[model samples]
Target chain A: MENRNQITAKQLGVFVLSAQVGLGVVGLPSDLVKEVGHDGWISILSAGILSTVITVIVIALLRRYSNQSIFEINRHLYGKIPGQIINFLLILYLGFLMVIGFRYFTEFIKLFTLKATPELFLALLIIAPTAYLSWYGLKPVARFSGIIFVILFFFLLLNLLTLKKIRVSFLMPVGAADLAALGQSIIPALLAFVGLELTVFLYPYITDKRNVLKWVIIANLCTSAFITIIFLVTMGYFGENLLKMQVAPLFNLARYYRAPYFGRVDLFFILLWFPLLESTFRSYFFTTYDCMRRYFSFKDQKLAYGLYAALTILLSRLPKDFTQATQLGKVVNLAGIAVFGFLSLCYLYSFFNKRGVKAPCGKS
Target chain B: MSTGMVSCVTIVVSTVTLIASLSLPPWGLGLPARILKFTALFFAALFGILGLIVTASVTFAHLVTLESLGQPYFQPLIPFKPGKYDRKKRP
Candidate 1:
């Protein structure tokens, strides 16, 4: 029987794109500028290449056990006790990602749109829809992501309109930064690509296994190209010194544009981008909920959903302010790097152990 | 109140009414079903009254989650199916 929950390779591609290009895109150029000045686009491109390579390794690992998710694959490769420990750690890492995403999103909303709204209430506003969507499972999440992905094109179009104001001289000093600075910038750039690792969790659900890697690589490249364009535009518009001081260069770039009828384009941009932001949050929130459910073996979906929502709400409020939230985001980004390393090590271990290979038996 | 505030209040009230009408069955239902329906209505009202953007966003999210015969209701509208709108052809 065909599984109703299965998503096509195309849906998977857009899902990855939506998840990878969240609130991070807003601040990524600024963060990279701080490290490498005008060479930030180079860092983004390099991170894209590195992430594509990692995607290959991840797909190769998952293809070994094509029927199982990363959670089950962990158990199949390692012993039961160790595998469960690893699964728990994975759950914790996903939870931290969700919390950080939530914190950054709420902080952004508070700063830009709803200043008087309490952080806790803003968190609830996000989690309300997140919980509702996640309750149905990954298929709904993937479908929602595909829809949001279409809306993201408008963002690109808006950014393109700002090209008229950009001074090419601002980007002239490119490659002026030393290789060490460019290398340091790559870590922050890689952080923006963190959601691409979700491929492991999504691999088993994909109906067309043969094209999964191709679509995934395409998604990663698209994200890289998209962010690189934004970075170049931001740098071109603001130059290095001014761009370095911006906390959210993408928004500022949008704010720079003046729509004749709308007056402030930034407000309209925020309204358009709101769904994409929620989509990103939903992607991480769904994955975290899925991992938590599997780890605890929760039978009641409502119970699992309720607990996760409450936990997210409480934990997201831990950051007292925007700076603290940014600090927490940095911590999560480092942890994301660590998780990527751990996944690569698992692949290596599986490669050497002949017993780790399994026949394609379909879903666990 | 200003015109914007009046429009916001009208939107919230209309949303709450629509939610209650849609969620609650006219035929008598069980206590649990009634409570669940009322709770959803309450949330719709709360989100609507809190902020216009939040209410609109939450509604949009909810609308996307609606499925018909196991297929996304808004699939063709979103995710943009150029010619394939036949229900039987989907999936």
Candidate 2:
């Protein structure tokens, strides 16, 4: 049966876009510059291509089952014990993503805008609304993604003012990073695109299911294009060596950018970031809440959302400092890689079983 | 005020404003969404300004008990009233 709250393909694309952007895009240029110079954009593009291929494999695996969520497919393909264990692992990953994403936002705000603000207070200021919004369910969240996509355009506009500072010579040594360096940057770049796994859960709730792959790939390309522009601009403005020292190259673009009768563009960009950050928070929490609901067979969704939000906020306090928070982020991305590996294995088994049986596939 | 006092005030004021903002839409009252949007924005701005002043408050445990029109306003932001407000009565 089709879900009444199903989102359209376009909205799904926006959801994927919002999920991937998060706070990672702000620091992406600096992080990549340390390794690949201007060729960092290439690393991001390669990661996008990799994500698309993995997404296709995930979609193929999903198509083998009849509209069942990944959590359900886990139980059906494996025994109940292993299935629950896998589901719990996926839940843990989503929980970790939520906590880390929150930490990143709080840190960014504290560093740039509110240097003396308490971490717990800032975390609540962001998480409270995000959890409240998640309570409204996927349809509202999908609708909110439309707003987030529009807000992202404001970042591009603010970024354009940095043109005055750009130097063509900075990008003259384009391939300076070499193939090996570019290859090394791919895994770190993949961390920025970790949320693509959202599709495995979102597919069943998407309208126009036939075009899911097309929309998702478009979303990936759009995100890559956006991040690439930021990378290009940052490299041209600061050069690779200077860019490496900056924490958030994209936000820094706004620090120097000036327009007619206006300044402090960085603060403006940060203000607009609430919706974008909240959208990412909601998407991860959706997976977390959905997993909890399925695991416990909980009928009261409000209670489930509350528990998820509380646990997420609790976990956010565990990281000792910014370095530990980032290390935890790397660990979570590694766990995400394992989850994708598991998905690929599921697909391989399905494909071989289909060939062997010669029976009509995708039935429950 | 001291740092701790500022945070305490920030959380208390923002919490009250958040409840008001969450509840003002009056989905039960059948108010137009535009008005609800404006009202919510007003409260949200108030909440944001107050929260910005403190920026370092504690957790959000108080929101759990907040309600709107006799309904839990924090989570499950929408109530499950089937066939009451919609053509299709699926909760």
Candidate 3:
């Protein structure tokens, strides 16, 4: 019988896409517009290219030890004590990512749909489903992500309705953004692509070892293309000045159009988008849960799930308002980048050491 | 009709389901499997309660945005499907 934990290469692609596309879709357009004018698409494209390179590096490193996750690889390369420390740090980082993404999702819901719902309750709504889905492990998460990926495609198609109202001239004088501006935009753009590094943890669970790289790269490209199209549409519809003022441009794009039956498409869109949002949240939640279980060698799985759920709910509510939440996000983004760099250094260390490279027979 | 009643009903239903489901199992479920079932049921209850709370708290403008099976849940009311509800034209 096939291993229950394993997912197909295509599922892997969808998994990464689902993870990368979440909170970024809501706010990325306005942020990019603020930083790069109409050339935000260009900045997103460049960030995509850069993220693809990092993904390739990550895949290359994982390829060396096909059977091991980064956790086990860390243990093997750095020895037990140091490896556990790095693993603990990785767990903390994953937990922080979960907290930040959870807060962002809840905050968006409060701002647009449920204005009166406490953030703590909103966080619980997401956390409950996330904890449930993650308890089964990667296979269920992967399957759910595949379903979300299809929904995401339909969401993207809905954007095309804005074409009638959009002024292509608004994106006129393309490439008007100077090189320095474009350069500055890449940091935020790169931040949008932060979830791609999830490939490191997902590498081993993927069943098709040979094509894992291709799938991950394809996933990143899909995300890049998805975000770029969203930016282009939002920029065309709202222009530079108006786009910068809107917090979540994607929702505005939905609101700009009305279907025959539904009056507020944005509200409908948010309802549809909730599962996609939850799918992304669950991905990070599962990763944190898995990492914690591995690090502590927890025998009681229920306790682990409860602890993680409690920890994320408590920590996610720390930011008082949008400004503070944005600041917290910035810290997480920087920490994500630093974690990626550290992973690369670990890859390099293993490459030169040769003797440290050993493929453990079982899963981490 | 109060929001509190809806929340109470949801919480009670969810709690009952969660408690009852724990006993009706295969009994041979390993620790992980048992946890999986518990997690699913626990969240189901929590979501039911929280979702009802949100449903009660949000305005009708926001509530009508929800749909079931691709059809507007509050159809012919919020959307005011006059054609669908035109009693004057009924033969």
Best by TM-score: 1
lDDT ranking from best to worst?
1, 3, 2
Model 1, B1-91: lDDT tens per residue? Answer: 4555566657778889788766756556456556654665675566433354555555566667677786568868655576777767755
Q: Which digits, one per residue and each the tens of the lDDT, describe model 2 over residues A1-364?
A: 1242477777788788888887668787887877777789889999888887888998777777757678877776776898789888888788788788888777877777767768787777777666655665666566556666557788877667677778989888767778899998987788778777888877778768778788888888888888888888888988879899998887777776766655566777776675676677778877677666657877776676677677788888888988888788778777777777888898887655442222365643
The per-prediction i-RMS, to one decimal, reads 3.2, 7.8, 11.9
Error of 1 at A248 (Å): 1.1
User: Which model, 1 or 3, shows the larger lDDT?
Assistant: 1
Tell me which residue pairs clash in candidate 3.
none
Show the lowest summed lDDT stretch of 10 residues, model 1 chain A.
Answer: A1-10
Better of 2 and 3 by DockQ: 2
Model 2, global lDDT? 0.72
- Predicted candidate 3 versus true structure: per-residue lDDT over A1-364, tens digit per residue: 1254577777778778888887877888998888888989999999899888888888878877756788888887888999888888888888888888888888888888778767777776656556665666676566666556556777778877667887899898988989999998888888778887777876777778888889888989988988988998888888999999998888887887778866678877776677777777878887777767767777777876787689888888788888898988888878888887888887788877654465556944
- Candidate 3's C-alpha runs over 4 A off are A1-3, A358-364, B1-91
Chain A TM-score for each of the predictions: 0.95, 0.93, 0.94
Which lDDT value does model 1 have at B27? 59
The TM-score that candidate 3 achieves is: 0.78
